[model samples]
Target: MFLDILLYIFIGIIVLQFIYYIGIFSVFSFKKAEKKNPNHVPVSVIVCAKNEAENVTRLIPELLNQNYPDFEIILIDDASSDETLEIFEEFEKQHSKIRLVKVENNEAFWGNKKYALTLGIKTAKKPYLLFTDADCFIPSNQWIAEMTAHFTEKKTIVLGYGKYKKIKGSLLNKLIRYETLLTAIQYFSWAKKGKPYMGVGRNLAYNQSEFYKVNGFIDHMSIRSGDDDLFINQAATKNNTEICYSLESFTISEPKTTFNSWYRQKRRHVSTASHYKFFDKAQLALFYACNISFFILAIVLLVTQHQWILVTALIAFRYLFTWISVGCGAGKLHEKDVVYWYPFLEVTLIFTQFSVFIHNKFSKPVHWK
Candidate 1:
C-alpha cells in the first residue's frame, strides 16, 4: 500500500512536468528570432560598475563599435574603490557619445544596485534605454539593433538572453551555463505568453518613461540588488513587455570560477525571488517542486519494485518532453552543448537550488556588487 501511494505521487509529478514542457516551455523553444528594427530610435546604453576596472576597459571599446547609429553609452561608477572611475573618465573624454554618472555610497541605501541604476536612468538623454553589465562581452555589433527590434510604441520593455562564457573541461561551467540557459528559457517563455514577470539586468532594455511609471524602483530600493527584475516585476505588463533571444543580441559574461563564489551568487539571486509577485513565486515553486520530486520518486519506486515498468515509462516520457523543449531552447540561444548534459546538470541544479532555499533561511545575501 505504501509503495503504491508513492507511485501515485510519482505519476502525478510526472504529469505536471509534462505539462510545463509541452505547454509553457515550448513557447520559446519553437519560436523564431525577431527581425531587424527599421524604426531604430536613440538609446542610452547603461553600464554600472563598482570595481571592475579591467573588465570595463575591454568593454568600452566594444560598446563604441556598435552598429546602431544613434546611441550613447552611460557608464555609471558606483563608488568604486579601484580605477573604474578613471577609466570611465578617459573614455568619456575620447568619445563624443560616451557619458559618465558618478554615484557615491548612500548611507540609507549602501551598496544598493537599484540606487545606482536609478541615478543612471535619470541621467539618460534618450527615449529608449538599454542596460548591460561592465563585465559582459559583446561579440556582435548588431546587439543594440536586434534587441530594439521588438520595441514598438506599445511594447516598451525588451528582454534578451545574457549567456555565460563556455569553459571547456569544467563541469561547473556547464552547470552554470545550463542554469543561465534555463533562466532565459523561462523568462522569455513567460514574456511570449504576455505575462512577463522578471528580466535580467545583463541584457534588458526599456523606455525611460516606464521607469518613471513605476516610480523607478522606489518600492524595493531599501533592499540591495533587484535593479533589473524587481523593476520589471513592477513595471512590465502583458501589453508592454517584449522578448528577444537572437544570437546577435546575446551578451556573454564570465561565470564564477569556484563553487563557493557560485553558491553566493546563486543565493543572492534566489533571495530576490521572494520579493516577486505572489503568482510568480507560486508557479515557479510548483515547477521546481515537481522537477525535483520527479527524480526522487522515480528512484524510490524503481528501487522498491512497485509497478516498475509503469514508473519507468513515466520517467522516460517526462524526459523525452524535457529534451525536446529544453533542447530547442538551447539551440535557439546557441547553447546546444549544454543540452546533452541537461539530464545530469538539471537534477544537480534543482537539488542545489533546494539546498540554497534551506540555507537562505538562516543567512541572506546583503551586497549587490
Candidate 2:
C-alpha cells in the first residue's frame, strides 16, 4: 500500500509539471508588442569588441545602415591585437554617428567585461542604451525600431530574443537551437507575467540613468560574467520591464562549432545562476527538479510493477501536450524547425543541463568575453 501511495504521489507531481509546462509556458502565445513610437527615443547602440576584426568588417556596416534616425553606435575597442582598431577607425571616419572608445588592456584594471561595459555605458551620449555583440547580425534594418517600440514610460528595460544561426545537417546544431528556444520560453513567459528575471546582452536595451541608479555591476564586480543577465536580474522589476517578440526585433549570432566550445559557453552562462536572487533560483530549481523527477519516477514505476499500459498513457499525454505548447512557441519565435527535435532534445537537455550545472560548481571558473 505504501509503494502504491508513493507511485500515485509521483504520478500526481508529473501531471502538475506537465500542466505548468503547457498552461504557464504557453503564455508566449498571447505575447504582443505594445504600440509606441519607435523613432521617438534616441538610442545609443553599444558593441564592445576585443579581437573581432573579421566580424566587425562584415557585420558593423549592417548595423550602421539601420533605418532609425537620431541614434549613435558606440564601438569599444578593448585593446585588440588584430585589425579591429583599424576597422573601427575607418567606420568612424565614414560616419559621424559612430563613436569609438579605445581601451588598452592593463593588468591594473579591476574587472573584466563588466569593466569594459561600464566604460562603454559611461561614454554613451543617448538617454536610452541598446547593446549587442560584435558577432551578432541584425536581420532587418528596423531592428532598433522594433526593439524600442516596446519601451514606455514605466518600462525601462527591454528584453529581446537572440538566436543562434541554423546550421544544416548537424544534430548538435539542432539541439543548440532547441535549447536556446526552451530557455527563451521560460525567460519570455516570466517577463510577460511581470516577473522579469533576466535578459540577454546580445540584444537588450534599457535607460542609461537606470543603470547608473543601480550602480551598474558594482555588486558583481569581483565575479566574472553577468554583464548582461545579472545586471538585468538586479535592476528588473514587475513594473519596470517589458519584452519584444517581433521577428523584426531578433538578432542572430554565430554558434560555436565544436561540442567543447559550446559546453564552455554554456558553462560560463550557467555560472551566473549562483548569483541570481533566491526567488529566481528557486523558480529555476523547481522546474529542473520536476523535469528530472518525471523521468526517474517513470523508470522506477515501470521496473517495480507491470503497469506498462498505464505508464505509456501517462507519458503519451504529457509528451503530446508539451509538444503542442512548444510547437506554438517555436512558431512564434520563427523557430518552426525546432519543434521537430523537441521530444528527443527536451529529455536530453534535462540530463545534459544537470551535468553542466554540477560541473560548473566544481570546475574552474569561466571568464568574461
Candidate 3:
C-alpha cells in the first residue's frame, strides 16, 4: 500500500505539470497581435550611465538620428569618473535636442541609478518617456516610431523587446539567450492576457504624468535595481499597458561573456522578485516549482517502480508538447535558435533559476545601472 501511495504522488505531480503546459497553450493560442497607428508624440529618450563612456560613444549618434520627429535624448551622467561627461558635452553641442542631467557623487547621493533616472524624468520637456541603456543599440531608426505608435488612448505603458547579441558559440552564451527568451515568454504572455507583472528596463516607455502620479519610485528608491520592473509593477494595468513587438522596435545589448559577470547580473535582477505583488509572485513561483517538480518525479517513478510505459509516455508527452508551443513563441519573438535547445535547456534553466532564487534570499543588494 505504501509503494502504491508513493507511485500515485509521483503520477499526480506529472498530471499537474501537464495542466500547467495546457495553461501556456491556452494563453498563446488565443492571443493575436493588435494593429497600431503611427503616433509622433514628442518623446524624451532617457539613458542613465555610471561609467559607460565607450558604449555611449557608439550609442548616442543612433539616438540622435532616429526616424521619429520631435524627440530629445536625455543623457544623465550619474557621477561618472570617466570620459562619459565629456563625451555627452560634445554630443550636446552637435545636437541641440540632446539634454544632459548631471548627478554629482555626493555623500548624500551616490550609487542609485533610480534617483538619477527620476531627475531625467523631471527635466524632460516631452510628454512621453522612452528608456534604454547606454550599452544597448537600436536595431533601426524606426525604433522610436514603432514604440510610440502603441500609445493609443488609455494605453499609458509600452513594453518593448530587448535582446542580447549572439556571441561566439559557448554553453553560457546559448543558455543566456535561451533564458532571455524564456523570460520574454512569461511577461509577454501574461501581458497579453491582461496581467502584466514586469518589463525590461532596456526598452520600455510610459507617460510623464504617470511617473508623478505614482510619486516616481519613492517606495522602492532604496532598491538599487528594478528601476524598470518595480515601477511598472506598481503602474501597469490591464487597460493601460500594451506591448510593442515590431522587429525594428527592439534593442540589442552586449551579453556578458564570462560566467561570473552573468551570474552577478542575474542575481541583481532576481533580487527584485521579492518586491513584486503577491499574486504575481505566487504565479511565477508556481511556474518554476511545477516545472522542476515534474522532472524530479518522473525520475523517481522510473527508478522505483520500473513503470517504464507510464513514465516514458508522460515525459514524452511533456517534451513534445512544450517543444511545439514554446517553439511557436520563439518564432514570434525572433528567437528561433532557442527552439532547438528547449529540451536540453529545460534541465539547465530550472536548476540554475532554483539556485539563484535560493541565493537571492541571503544576497546583499548590489548597485545597478
Candidate 4:
C-alpha cells in the first residue's frame, strides 16, 4: 500500500509534466515567428565589454557587416584595463556608424555590467535598441532585420536565440547546448502562452521607451548578472513581448570548454532566478522539482518490483511523450542531435542544477566577466 502511494505521486508528477509539455511548451515547437514588420526602423546595436579585447575585435567587424539599414553600433567600454577602449575608438574613426561610450569603474557599482549598459542605452541615438555580448557573432547579415521585423506597435520586446557552437568529440559542448536549447524552449513557449518572463541579452531587442519606463535597470542595478533577464522579467508583458526564431536572427558564441568554467558561468545565471516574479519563480521551481521527483520515484518503484509491469509501462509512456515534445523543439532550434541524448542530459542537468543551488546557498558569484 505504501508503494501504491508512491506510484500515485509519480503519476501525478507525470500528469504535471504533460500539462507543461502540452499547454505551455507545445506552441513554440510547432509555431513559427511571424517576423513581418517590413520597416527597418532606426536601430542602435549596443555591446558592453570588460577585458574582452580579443573577442570584441572579432565582434566589431562582424557587427559592422550587418545588412540592416539605418543602424549604428554603440560599443561601451566598461572600465576595461585592456585595449578595449582603444579598439572602440579605432572602429569609431574607421566607421561613421560606430559610437563609443566609456564607463569608468564606479565604486558604488563596481564590476557591474548594468551600470555600463545603462550608460550605453542612454547614449543610443535610436529608439530601438538591440543587445549582444562582446563574443557573439551573427550567422547572417540579416540578423537585425529579422529581429526588428517582430517589433510592431504593440510588441516592443523581441526575444531571439543565442546558441553555442557545437564541437565534435566534446561532451561538454553537447551538454551546454542541450541546456541552452531547453531553456530557450521554455522561455519562448511561455512568451507564446502570454506570460513572458525573460530573454537572452546575446540576441535581445527592445525599444528604449521600455527602458526609461522601467527606470532603466535601476531596480536591480546592484546585481551584476541580470541586465537582460531581470529587465525582461519586470518589463515584459503578454501584449508587449514577441519571439523571433528566424535562422538569421540567431547569435552564436563559443561554449565554455571546461566544466569548471561552465559551472561558474551557470552560478552567476542561477543567482538571478531568485529575483524573478513570483509566478515565474514558482512555476520554474515546480517544473524542476517534478522532473527530479519523476526519476526518483520511477527508479524506486521498479527496483522494488512492486507492480513492475505497470511502472514499466508508465515510464515508457512518459519518456515517449517527452521525446516527441522535446524532439520537435530541438529540430526547430537546430539542435536535433541533442534529441537522442535527451534523457541522459536531462538527468545530469537536474542533479548538476541541484548542486548549483546548494553551492549558491553558501557562496555568491560577482563580476560580469
Candidate 2 wrongly placed segments (more than 4 Å):
30-37, 108-111
Residue 321 lDDT in candidate 2: 80
Model 2: per-residue Cα lDDT over 322-354, one tens digit each: 888788888888888978878788888888899
Every candidate's lDDT = 0.90, 0.85, 0.84, 0.91
Rank list by TM-score = 4, 1, 2, 3
* Stretches of candidate 4 exceeding 4 Å from the true structure: 33-37
Cα lDDT tens digits, model 4, 151-170, are 88899999999999999988
Ten consecutive residues with minimal summed lDDT in candidate 4? Answer: 30-39
Query: Positional deviation of 263 in candidate 1, in angstroms?
Result: 0.7
Worst 10 residues of 2 by lDDT: 29-38
Model 3 over residues 1-369: C-alpha lDDT tens digits?
A: 765665677667666655655575436533565657789999999999888999999999899879888899999999999999999999998889899999986565478888899899999999999999999988699999999999977998999889999876677887888888778877877787798989999999999988998999899998888899999889998899988876889899999998888888888898898899998999888878878887777777777765678778877887877777677767767888867877778789898888888788776746664
> Which scores higher on TM-score, 1 or 2?
1
For candidate 1, lDDT tens digit of each residue in 69-100? 89999999999999999999999999999999
Q: What is candidate 2's CA lDDT for residue 221?
A: 81
